[model samples]
Target chain A: MKISELSECSGVSIASIKFYQREELLPEPERTSPNQAQYDTQHVDRLRLIRALVDVGGLSVATVRTVLAAAESDIPMDWAMGVAQRAIPGSVELPATTTRGVSEIDTITETLGWKVSPDNPGRGMAARVIDSYVQLDHEEILSVLPEYSRAAMIVAAADLASVGLQPSRMRMSETVVVGTVLGDSLFAGLRRMAQEDEARRRYAQVQS
Target chain B: MKISELSECSGVSIASIKFYQREELLPEPERTSPNQAQYDTQHVDRLRLIRALVDVGGLSVATVRTVLAAAESDIPMDWAMGVAQRAIPGSVELPATTTRGVSEIDTITETLGWKVSPDNPGRGMAARVIDSYVQLDHEEILSVLPEYSRAAMIVAAADLASVGLQPSRMRMSETVVVGTVLGDSLFAGLRRMAQEDEARRRYAQVQS
Candidate 1:
């Protein structure tokens, strides 16, 4: 297939395909002549994955390259999961001085028996939000930490289950990366709809 | 309180406070002299909200201004909720030609008996994710839509409950805005931790 066909089939523009190739996110095609190159179905698939990661996942080119490399490795699923979680923007490393928020996250995870590592970027990410709540004097929101944790467990189980359903390790790796990134957007979108629904129910009762 | 005191009290830097003032996300303080102004506790509170929305929530300065204005209005909570939902980045308006994804989302929301409006940005946001799944040929992951939706409802209920706990309407409005923004990050971070725990449990068994 030609680059134009790759663009048409994968729904990514030819310019983006070239950009990804330059970024080393996509592999170079076999040269048919001085200027012509031939792509294949694998290129199409890779382009689709790259588009999903960049457009929907909002991952940077560097992170996407890292994730793609991890996904294509031998222990693809495990490596992809780690790479995807770490690639998540804003999952910063905790400053050594910030123990209070991290400790609160530890307490919650401990109560849940999650056994998550101390250095999991998620720990820092979650603690930062928790710290914001405390800083703003909205500590009451933390009261629902248990419920959020429980809900997270349910969704995580579903996430892993979905990954498990994939027929191949490669597919599993792709699912892990895509699900980790797009799943956040998916759940956030659904949560907004649910919030509107809940708000209407509660506020309607108040009016009635 | 002076600007410096406001920054100290709110934990936002003086420069950022000035930026917020320039953006009109924060109201002007009372001018005490040609070069000095007097800020009160309200300014401190406002700065905290602005920081939460920008830092934790990742909202843009323009959106923060809109959300703050809505939060300060008479029918604050309702307006704040609506504004915050719309302000969420990546909640693009669906093309009119696009009906399949939206209909799919409609089915899920309807099955859950959620009375969400068609125009709700969340509808478009979730639909776009669904469309991405289809485009990537990873539609199998949609098998967990129900589980994700269920978890979203759980978190949404907690969100509204936390907002309801606020003692004043203004505080309620602030909670709605902050919760709508930060809640997404909070849940995403926890979900990552949960995924790590689930992967460890599942894979550790395989290794054993």
Candidate 2:
């Protein structure tokens, strides 16, 4: 089909389609002409996933491409899970039910407490959370995870963008590090602290 | 204090302070000179709140301003609770206690279930989550909240995006409505249904 049709089908724009092609997110389809390229349903699906990753998932094109390659590798879930481990150490082994809610949160609080106090209250909370996990049904708990994941990414992206966070290398590094290290909450927390800290200064300067 | 001093205290840059001043997140400070403006501690606190709402709370600047104004107007906690009926109607008021434990989680789940669903599996799991919540003191629970809130905002924002996720929006709105009216698992069952649907899609997509 035409690139226009691809754009309409993918809900991405014609210009975006061209850009994705350039980014190699969309495979270069067999071309009938120098400018016109034939696209297919796979292109649509791949672009859709890319759209989900980049637009909804807020992954960078390069990152999205890497994830796509992994998905396409048709690698076993084990390998995929292995790759995921780097982002979350125990997540691959998380009871599918509890991966949605992992020890990471407790880990987060523990980490914070370690930083701020020897005994952080968050530390205990994480424990109860893990114990509770023993009883939750897998499918039931796993279901909420996508919502949690998507929400975190979406908000993080919006926050980053709102701040005009730049120097892609620095910003992207921050994104990866925060997402990996802080387990969601602190990732969200630090940014909020920074933004508020910044806003407070500005508000004071403006206000008498 | 001068703008520079305000910036120093607030930890925001001079430019952002000027911007917030222009945006009115801060009231106009006393101008001490042709090139200087003065701010106070009150200004500092208010600016801090503004940043908290916008950055931590994921509120837009306009929304942050409105929330602050409403806060000034003495919007009752009950009123806000009433409005929150959709997300969690039957749910009990957030526990006043900063510290919580498994028993508290059980109580909240039971109380919430009475109004929502008695056999709601999610409630059971939420109760389990108490174990996790219990690990930390109140601050830790709150620390997790910003992450949770950001996650919610991400989904809300994503729904607003996604071309015409009108259906997704409608579903969420209905969830709110169900939460408000049915105040039960009516909406939750719907959420479970969505997960089932997503699972089906995943299965089918993988096969195809």
Candidate 3:
């Protein structure tokens, strides 16, 4: 099939198809003549996958190349499954509720799995945020839009897996990168507003 | 002290302090003379807090305004506590783990907190990625670390937080905006690669 046909079938633009070919995500078509390049089923399928990741999953071309290479090895999948079994790999989970007025130096040192400074001003807050998240009851999270949030994450995860599941080493290193990006960007944005709301309440309490 | 003195004392650049002034992150300083503005201890402190928010907390200027308003309310702090109690509000929390193969339609519905068509082709894959994340275990994640990979996020988060938190609201809001932009750009790039990787893996898995 021609690139145009592939583009229509794959729901990707003709220009994109050519770009991917250059990026090597789409294999260079066999040249039937100086001006003619013939693509086949494999080309079509590759384009389909590429389109899904770029358009739907939102991965970059460079990261896609890395993930493509990583996924090629059965070893990577084995490692990913292994990591999945232990932790989501590249992530830390924290609870939202806790009386732990910011973790002390020791707590941060331990949590960071390092010997970070004890009096680092920011360290306390970071530890506090982590502690708050860790201490927060799972139910607490549920109390806020109990059904909707999980549904979104789960669906996004599935979409992510369908796009590629070869751990994070490929494509910027997996769920955490994507998750962190989204969490910090989307959810964190919402959370900041929420914090402001909370801070407002705190101020009001002081005044009263 | 003049505005320049405040800048020097606070270690904030003149340009940034001016930006903060323009953004209303700082109250209008008393004008010492027609062309000059006089700053004070309170202004110094406010500048410090503003630096924390913009440089440390990583929030945007707009968010900083909201947060600042919250902090500056005439309402008593005691009254603010009552408001803090309500800050969490209600949110949805679906099953931490998702069923495999839910459609892209379902994924979109869930993310947007609305309904979507199941017949959509990409929906199924979308659900899988999120499910896989929910399914990841702590150990699995730890095992996948490439030497020092385990510490990278910890370090990044710590540094990222420090940059904007000292000024509290202004810096914090800027940090959050940076996150938003990063998500919009970086994640989109990575997801593209993921889709192709998954397709190739599935094909190879079946073939073998």
- With candidate 3 superimposed using the best TM-score fit, by how many Å does residue B70's alpha carbon deviate from the native? 4.3
**Stretches of candidate 2 above 4 Å error?**
A2-19, A28-38, A74-208, B1-76, B80-208
* lDDT string, candidate 1, A1-208, tens digits: 9989888988788888888898888888999998899999889877777777776667888888787777677663554577767776656678577566788888988888887767787788788888877877888999878888889999999999998898765567668778887788889889989989988887643542
Top model by DockQ, which number? 1
What would the per-residue lDDT of candidate 3 be over residues A131-190, giving only the tens digit for each residue?
332332111211222122222233234444433544334333444333433322333222
Better of 1 and 2 by TM-score: 1
lDDT for each residue of candidate 2 in B6-65, tens digit (9 for 90 to 100): 888887778988888788878898888888777998777656555544443345566555
- Candidate 3 Cα outliers beyond 4 Å, as residue runs: A27-45, A52-63, A78-208, B1-4, B13-39, B53-67, B75-208
| lDDT score for residue A57 of model 3 | 39
The positional error of residue A101 in candidate 1, measured at the CA in angstroms, is 1.6
Q: What fraction of the true interface does each of the listed models get right, in terms of native contacts kept?
A: 0.69, 0.05, 0.04
Measured over all alpha carbons after superposition, the RMSD of each candidate to the real structure, in angstroms, is 4.3, 20.1, 13.8
Tens-digit per-residue lDDT, B75-179, candidate 1:
635555777667666676875875657878889998999978677878878888888888788888898899999999999899989988888765776687677
All DockQ scores: 0.53, 0.04, 0.08
lDDT of 3 by residue, B36-154 (tens): 88888877777765554554335557755665665457545423322222222122233344454243224334543422223221133333334443443212321221211112222
Candidate 3 interface RMS: 15.8
Error of 3 at B169 (Å): 11
Q: What C-alpha lDDT, on a 0 to 100 scale, does residue A3 get in candidate 2?
A: 84
